[model samples]
Target chain A: MTENKAFCSRCGVEVEPHKATCPLCGTSIQQTEEEEPTSYVKKYPDEPAVKTEKTGRTAKQKRIFIWEVVSVTLLIPLLITLFVDLIVNKTVTWSLYPISSLILAWFLISTPLLFPNILPLLYIGETLPPAIFLLVIDKIEDGQINWFLDVGLPIEAVVAVIAAIVIIGSIKIKNKGMNIAAFILFGAGLICLGIDFIVLKHTRGTFGVSWSLYVLTSTAVIGGFLLYLHYRLMKNTKLQRKLQI
Target chain B: MNSSNFPTKKTDEESNQNHIQKAPKKDWFRLDNAATVFSFVTSTRIPCMFRFYANLKKPINVAILQQALENIIDRFPYYKVNLRNGLFWSYWETNPGMPVVIEETKYPCQKMPIRKKGIFPFRVRAYYNRISVEFHHSITDGTGALIFLKSLVGEYLTLIGVVVNDWQDVFRPNQEPHYEEYEDAFKKNYQKNLPGPPRVSKAFHLPFKLEPKGVFHLTIGIMPIKQILNKSKELDVTLTEYLVAVYLEALQDILFSLPLRKQKRLLKPIRLQVPVNLRRFFSSKTMRNFSLYVTPYIDPRLGHFSFDEILKQVYHYMRVEVSDRYISQQIARNVRGELHPLIRLTPLFIKRLFGKIIYNGQGEFLYSGVITNLGKVSLPEPLNKEVENIQFLSAQSPVTKTGCAVNSYGEKLYINFGRIIKEAHVEKLFFRKLVKDGIKVRIETN
Candidate 1:
């Protein structure tokens, strides 16, 4: 053991007996021909025990199992509807509506259950299913895509945009008390104006606004008052004391 | 509740049966001022945990250690609670489930599942001759943890037929915990109208990439206490002062060694967050977080500093900043923030978001590194003789990249560095400097 003493020429610190490489600098320690190699006893065990808690099922496994069960449950209704449609009509006819509606329902419910934490996918899940359902209904009724594009898609886009702003704004804002309510009020006003514009252009063949003007005016006043209360009055501690509820 | 509420004596069979029984319903505690922040910032990458262990002369008997843990756990009831979320703050609820002793892991301070219902905030593990306890910072500071470790070691020794007559500072298993032990010392000692400590500028951080999540690197350097003590004495400074200067000097070396352009870009002060245990200054036995930090720094942009200059700066800074007046200012600031009407009215989820922002902006971001010294550990009589050495390992910080914990047992001082980055530059420079300063260091890594 005494002959196994070795030092790293680079670091000048004595390593453990018979270590080929320095633990600090990873420099190779040269061994002498006359010295015998010695096995170093480790202070701590090298292999880590896999840290796991004993439970009946893990959270991820449970989620996956629930997703599988829901998928199978939805599959039963879809298979039954298609079988009934085939048995009734020689080819495919009115079964298209139920089939499409069931498929849309399955997509809408399953996206949130399976990928609940993914934000982008959730937004798509919220917007895409309704858009597809509207398009299918429009085609089955009029045999052309007229109201779906002009009315349904535009309204869905407006709602999605406004909802995205409110959700993302609430999450990113530092002090989330009255400011979140203000954001929602502002979003509500924007959605009203958007709906009025789209419906006027689709129905009257002219882009104009009417009743939504009254709704927008009321929401803007309330939203503006809330913003003023949050940024101005709420910041004054003396005022807060006097106005304590 | 006082000592009378706890049953002191039980038969061996009864004690064994009571090991896993439901904890009696006790009044829950609000998370201490310092602990509230730890709860917000704890994650898989930064566990916000620390470990204190004693190495025995012989290999550990697992069954005896487990029995010893089960016997003594009821004494430290404050540590046996689980973290519970509240409307405006998080509190500790007494957990009915028992905390079991398990085998030690290769990594020292892995994350504890404190957010889970019924899980305790601390764990005890045994590996070979070493018995270790890892505590979440939300539960207690080093002083509190050391007492628990001493009590556990004492009970373990007594079970294995060792007579420990000197029970000086160690809490025996049969003793009921004092009411004072459950007090939040920071709030108790907080002064109402003191000025808060000045805000610090952002210090230079290590530019190394972070390691994969859950991978922590620990390197321990064991040296003779007398040698380092003599060196500090020769320099006319305390052990902590000497070590902090060495750390700053190492950072300076790494700073100046970079390319000129990079060095210019990274010309910030090198500061270390040194935790000062408040129980020393304030008279309290609260087993929760009761410590704050004083940052001793050297601005490299001023000029190149010799080791003597660095040592003088650290010595003076620590002398002035670690006093009762200065420490009280920090406590005042923390308690005041918690007491503010706006902050108190905000919900816990909002506070958590604000905590993340503050932790990123002002927490570890303001310090280059941390060095926590538990000072010297002393156990009673024959138990001390059976214990070979004691080690303290600080938690891994993803932002700071490295942290150092120092403690001494018997003749040896163990300086353990816990890192979460792939680079070992800080550890290499620190130990190599000590070796150059005429201290013999034996290196151990995990």
Candidate 2:
């Protein structure tokens, strides 16, 4: 009953409504739609260039803000626990702090999407408070590197590991990166850990330092594995090609 | 029975009877209506689609979906690994060796497209009772996914049944998953990757506590057509544009009744991530998952936007995303690259943390839903007669609490919604208005 004069884009053939493509000649043409234009851009880590440019946004600026917020907020509880650890060294074992710090950072900083609005507050709260504490701690402690060898460096290692995995993963998954800082961070943490294990354990006791070999061995294994991966990455040149964002 | 075994209808006219088959390509990657209605794009723990098959029988067997999924996953390895000692040509640019399973989600989707790991924002899931999937905006558009789903359904049918003719010319024969047809992917000339920074936003969109009112079993039958461009023009949009607007209007009415604000701030536009086909980009149709996304954000202003306006926007947006040159270049590059190069090397623990890094706060607008219209499905009539109806439903995981799905066959459109938002007002408003607007609306409960 309806006079359908729609023609297929692939092949110039008139087709009726709801007809997928031309019948006389098979051609893939678009279905007709007269809908409103979408001004909203979907949030994707790796947005297409046209999409990114259309929105007048860059992945770099956003990352700096997010990292500034998240990384800072994540530093808070660590400082708090550190602040708490200094006063009550006899009461609480120092070793437990890094584990707790890891927990707090992973749950608090890592997965803020689970808790929506409180996220920004969590960021601001994490930032200003910690900056003040670090200032005070710097004045109180003697310039000796004991804290660095003990609670301080371990906590840093945990933070670095968490940051690296998250940053690298985000870059790979979301398609934005400059996690060169994160790489240095995690790499430094790993190096620190190796140093702390070898030197601190030897300094602490002759017998206990034997366990450092195990740590060294594990690090070598991980390093070797990374080498294998780097080789594979070189072998597999697929990751180099980026989709037109 | 094989392709040769399909029944030759007495005439092309008889075969092309409003066969209720889904049109192909455009809107093939479109998703359900509920996917559009909500503001949050959902993700899952990755194991939901996996079900240990117990009694693998005829209908509702987990094996059908599982085997199909597994078969698809298994097919790419031969291409990924340079097995033939370089005797077989290797396209190193868009190699199949890229990790399809992301580190954190390990979601088994989208190995081809160089984007996020999981088909987050949207994906497809197959269950024992049903199969559902939600894909992000990076994959194919709705129309494209629909065509693929039909192909999947046809392949499923082929797996289950032996096609035959009235004269018994078609005979029983085992169908082998011949991946040989796809072996030459790397040798293709159209190889290149679009270079762009990842799109992340500063604004945060929160999920309005909504649940699936009910799961609607839209028994969509396919019409005999190579693709469904005809109906789209009649509807005045691309196939996805039309269906999405239909559902969006339906959702606006429903959300309007929910005692909510007049103008909400969290208008995380309903992002329509449709899959675009790269077959035109490919030298052959033998490759697996040769699709990408044409994502468009729908303004959830409800009744403010007309169907005509929405279509105009969605159609052009999609066209630009999946333009012929873009599709072919992506395919060429993908075929050239190697698979799982970095990811295969990364430890699982580190990989789990990867999603958090990239997705944590890269973008502002939250994705509302994903629609993949696999396009029209024209099975050999002999095979079509046996199918009561083929449905594609993703695992309705509790991750995001709401999702949408769509599959259409010619005149009949299936807008199956999977959500936990217990609001019927949206469904009621949609069904009523659809019929009022002359769309033959049908409702089914399964």
| DockQ of every candidate structure | 0.11, 0.03
lDDT of 2 by residue, B116-143 (tens): 3322233334433333343432222333
lDDT tens digits, residue span A1-245, model 1: 34466776766766776677877899998875555676654666676444443433433456578878877887787788878888988666777788788788878887866775466998899888988898988898768997998999999899998998887777666654566678888899889999999999998989789999898899889988987887777764433322221
Query: What is the lDDT for A207 in model 1?
Result: 76
For candidate 1, the iRMS in Å is: 8.6
Worst 10 residues of 2 chain B by lDDT: B82-91
Q: Candidate 1 chain A — worst ten consecutive residues by lDDT sum?
A: A236-245
Cα RMSD, each candidate: 12.4, 16.5
Given the true complex, what DockQ would model 1 score?
0.11
